[model samples]
Target: MSGEPLPPVKRVVIVGGGTAGWMTAAALSRLTDAGVAVTLIESEEIGTVGVGEATIPSLLDFNRYLGIDEDAFMAATGATFKLGIEFVDWADRGDRYLHPFGIHGRDVHGVKFHQIWLRQSRLAGRMGQVGNVSDYCLANQAAASGRFTRPVPDPAAVLSSFSYAFHFDASLYARFLRGLAEEAGVQRIEGKIVHVDIASDDGCIRAVELADGRRAEGELFIDCSGFRSLLLGDALGVPFTSWQHWLPCDRAVAVPSASTSAPLPYTRATADSAGWRWRIPLQHRVGNGHVYASAFIDDDEATAKILDNLDAPPLDAPRPLRFTAGVRERLWERNCIAIGLAGGFLEPLESTSIHLIQSGITRLMSLFPDTGPAIAERKEYNRLLRQEYEQVRDFVILHYHRTNRTDSDFWNYCRTMAIPTTLEDKIALWRAKGRIIRDQGGLFSDDSWIAVLMGQGLIPQSHDPLADALPIEEAGRFLDHLRDVIARTAAAMPRHIDFIASHCRSDLAA
Candidate 1:
């Protein structure tokens, strides 16, 4: 009897090596049995788009799934915990809001917190606008105060019950995953894939032909070839759907700058004339990028805009990247599956790039076939991947479309332009009823849309009628009490810089 555990995926080939490639390999290696053979091929000449330094709370699950040591990973990557993102000047100008990780506040008398706040705002002589939604969220408060503390194990402290993620060096993270993938019996091939050989009978990719005349054959092929898309797009011929109309910022200029005095525990995205600039603080340096549409701004100006907006002195030359913002019509073609830039390029506004890659790898693992790739399996993979990408794309578009900024041509287009009907319907419903169209497939929660909608000055026409069931004075008192409690709790926490220094600081930060 064969000792092997039934040979689930005997051979697997990964044709890329950046964060996406390595992350997929590392994850699949950990999840599958010993009989599986995973191979990753890449060229030293190729470069990775590694500006994705900031992340959301979903990373907690991915890290735990990878069995990564949190402190070690943070220290190695020069990670700073991110509670949420602060959007600057997005509504009109000089306006801001933080899109936090968790819920706003505890519901009272079985009523939604925002509805209660809305009810209070209607009361005569109410001083506060009650629109500062982040106050009730511990993570958002922690971010605003420039403080960080792991939720204490005690259940009573609301601070201990909150969530967070990391802002770190993307390159360092790739190296970390590479090490794990290699240790788990993944064969790392160092060469450029010059060609993909195909089988005559099935037309599936038979093997990847490297520049050095080496052929890497596998029963199933994964194209992680970044924008080159060597196997799935170039060889198998899958069409890509361009979403430039919906997500128009097709160019990006990224630069890393020396750290500000001490790194903060959150990422900042400030709206600009052409597009927006992202500021991600790591231990030793800050990652900066200006994403814009080339139609409105030239390369020289965009580069200058990015350089002028840096938090510190430039540490390296600015690198520019151009991409058509969209996903492939088919993520998996024949026996080959495309991941990362090969799959599609959605802007990293919410840092969904890595998360999408992780999800793709996981879905593949779940649908792992004993034989060659099946159409049913491929179809399901594409369905989930399309939904995930579209959902994130729509959410990112909301930030731009709902804005009141008509200062620049770019902003004017974003503000007045027609958007996806799905998004329009969601916004229209919220404006009338203060109710979010909850969808499980949607990446953002009701709290998220509420933050952006309210931040962009989209208040509901009227408060939730159900909230009227409570006495007017009682509703006002509850709202005031929650706000006070949140403020007091946040005031008692340590500074974010101090929290990192005490718990997660490594040689990188030191």
Candidate 2:
């Protein structure tokens, strides 16, 4: 970029159509100008592993950027509000905790609420019963009590900033985004990528030959072809860096079930002998899945576990999905970029699949590739995507490694396995002083680390000293106030289901 003109890679072809494909389409349509051409080629024949229905709060930004109507999106996607994720038995049998969206209570006396809570626990000399920090967190309290609302917190207060995400049918979301992107000038082609035409000397893909024998050429290519990675890996030969050793869960069996009970405001992930089960409450139905280590469990056993653990009667046959845990060595190389499952797969242990896809799209926009770069830009882009993936990977691994469970071989293995050095350092720092070190490019925030670390029983050796600055009686009053305020605010919100009924409900929701 040092005086060199941005190389023109005007025509772009995206090769797939699920959440990733349409998400890419929606973003590109917004960025590309009138003359620039964007074509997306996806066949209806190939099935999508459309179980990526849960998301993080950050998705609000994506929707806001696209100016997508919230009610319309909800109606089209059969969406339910997601306040957070509930981890059941991750630390030990029968234990449950939530990793809520948004921040916890307001920092008091320039100290985090959790730190103050830690000090209060020490003052009370309560041993086994750790302070329930979430008791004061707005989103957590609201989720616990089945409440939902658009936040209108006072500028000086903490609860005002509570955030939320959504649980929607993935296929419907893709369709919804497809409409947005197409209406914004993105051309959609229905076909399979039979072969990738590449420039022989540079090895950069030039076009994709559709099964219909029509040639769709582009100066740049986006590979959203899911696991096959048609353009990036399959055609271009980009290497994949596997992380199967650290994240042992390689397969999942997904099934939708009829609504059996009132939908929970959060996703529920329950631990088991071989792996874990996810219950995502969509407005109309529940998306259930069992993700397990294929090495330790068979398809039948895995599917059985999923069916046995379902909260409602099965609505459809279970669908199996398989993948290794890792990312493409280079998400972008030459003129091609890989997004979504083509880029990597970290178990949705934290509902990060959509988040990571968003990350890739955002990063691609920032370091948007051209026919030529300064060489440094490519290096920087690769470094950033690599770091993003590693940071997210480690965060997911922390849940498995920081736990106290040992009831099964899966649990025993996870409990003792060595983790990434980066995660180990973070854990060590938190234990030493209850301090969290944030990676500038990392997606997870300090509060996020605290929530998971404390939820999984990683008690810090010492509390934040700032907490000691306040007198014990004063701290008690503040903590009580925080708890009471959260209770009242959450109580004032509409019931979770009622919120949808009154504000966002539609034919899909029913």
- Candidate 2 clashes between residue pairs 3 or more apart in a chain or in different chains: 153-160
**Model 2 Cα shift for residue 282 (angstroms):** 0.7
Cα lDDT tens digits, model 2, 2-112, are 343445877888889989999999999965674678889888899677789999988999999889899889878889999889999998888898988867777876887
Best-matching candidate per TM-score: 2
- Model 1 segments beyond 4 Å from truth? 1-8, 31-34, 127-131, 152-157
After superposition of all CA atoms, the RMSD between model 1 and the true structure is 3.2
Backbone clashes, each candidate:
5, 1
Candidate 2 segments whose C-alpha is farther than 4 A from its true place: 1-7, 124-130, 370-374
